[model samples]
Target: MAAILSKIKTEAEGTLRLLWKKIDPNDLKPGDHIYSHRRYGLYSHHGIYVGDGFVIHFIQTETKNNVLRLPKAEKFAHRPPCPKCLYDEYKDLGVVRTCLDCFCCHEEKLHSIRYFVYGAPRVGLLLKKSGTCTTLVSSRTANEVVEEAYELLRSQGFGEYNLCQNNCEHFATFCQTGKKLCTQMSFYHDLEEWVKRRIS
Candidate 1:
């Protein structure tokens, strides 16, 4: 039992290294921004890693936007509350710190969402499919990112989690870059405008 429990966590890494390398949950450094595709790759849940296999993230308890849905039956699960984080404690959307296992849920893979692509690397990444990474660069150092995450966890200063105005990606990006960004949502908004223009 002990040996199995101590086994290497390879299943935690991404299977595809096409653009940004899939991150191993165990190898995550403090302040690393990571995410996992949920709801069949429709959207991802983002967070900031604070080492020790823990992650700080935002969650909107009643969000119905993302196309991600939970079966009604699981709402009445017989399981106990999570130990590492009283995950059940955050009944409302706010900053919360949880172990990576809880953060990623049952997902086998994770991605480092915030990355700097430059010069030749940018060329290769641009050639890949979208949603794989972002071109935004962070001016903040790792320590700075970690500091902000902890601060928000304590203050819940991020306000209510909104699927658009503010969200998980926004929270993690704010920690890592000291600014909020949600490119995917931005992409959708742009696409919506384009459709309207064509229809008009």
Candidate 2:
């Protein structure tokens, strides 16, 4: 049993090492945009790393009404409600700061179905571009960007979470630049193009 447990631990560590290799710990700076897409290719989530192994991102939390409803619904149904069903019924919670470990631990916990990391272009491109294509623009120093993000997080203090106008990507970009933008918009736009191409 001891040998079996040791082998399992070794395999888990090895898997983590492989995952970490994809991301350079040295390159992670405060205010840096970290993004990942859902496994189904529908959407993405973004956050600003605030250094010291923490990330600040907008998260949706269940509303009081929904919380109140769950028990009654479950009692009536004679079984627990589906997690996805509960999530669909809940309201947005808002911005939150969490350790990177918790943030990336599991997608379902975050209410994301599944997620995989991907490289994001420089913050400048995201700020300056209003369309699918990217263009260079003036960039802030890393320190300045990080400070801005921290300040915003402090000032905002968990405001509403709006998927279209305000979201995790908006929060990250706002920290990097004073602009609010959604990266998922481009994904949707591209998807629209793909569908149009297929139909036409």
Candidate 3:
């Protein structure tokens, strides 16, 4: 999709500035909701609109070699706060721009969905068992899966585990080996018998 945030209005035109002295990184929230058509990707709601340029957001750099770019904002509420300096220049204007089209949100969704059952409790249960992090489900690589889960572990007061390069190798090998083993096992299993009967 396009990187453009949203439709800008003439009324919203003016010099706008943002300061993040008080805002914490954790303040960023997801805007995407369940069951909405456009709710798939754009997840987090926090964004920082530094004037004279584009709005800023953080892409979570993952341990598994992926980036979930989040929409970063200086002012985050139901409505964008009209700064005092911008009021004179843009008070009479219409909506200039909105914080949307978040790449991080989209990426986060991708990371979440790859392993988890879409919007299911089983997904969380499985991920928790497999030591995966919680993210918006969509499509993502296996490495991003475990790494995201590890982040969650840390946040939950679990002691930070040393990130080892071997973990990456182990992850790739385990996934590959597991798939191969399952494929091999399927040939001797009841699933194969069921498929053969359906075809016969």
Clashes (N, CA, C under 3 Å) per candidate = 0, 2, 27
lDDT (10s digit) by residue, model 1, range 28-67? 6886777776766577788888888888898874533332
Alpha carbon lDDT at 155, candidate 1:
88
Instruction: Tell how far residue 29 is off in model 2, in angstroms.
Output: 2.0
Candidate ranking (TM-score, best to worst): 1, 2, 3
The alpha-carbon RMSD values of the candidates against the true structure, listed in the order shown, are 10.8, 13.1, 21.4
In candidate 1, how many Å is residue 86 off?
3.0
Candidate 2 residue 54 Cα shift, in angstroms, is 0.6
After the best TM-score superposition of candidate 2, give how far the Cα of residue 123 lies from its true spot, in angstroms: 17
Candidate 2: C-alpha RMSD after superposition:
13.1
lDDT at position 2, candidate 3: 38
Ranking by lDDT: 1, 2, 3
Off by over 4 Å in 3: 1-42, 63-200
lDDT of 3 by residue, 1-200 (tens): 23332322211121011110122223332221111011432221222232222222222223221122335422322233334322221121211222232212232242221111122233233323121222224343544433433343244322222223212212222222221111112223655799899999
Per-prediction TM-score: 0.72, 0.56, 0.16
lDDT for each residue of candidate 2 in 1-200, tens digit (9 for 90 to 100): 99977776665554334323445545676756665445543555667777886667776545646546665655432223334222222332566566665455344444221211222233323332232112223166768867776675677654677667777777766666666766467657776999999999
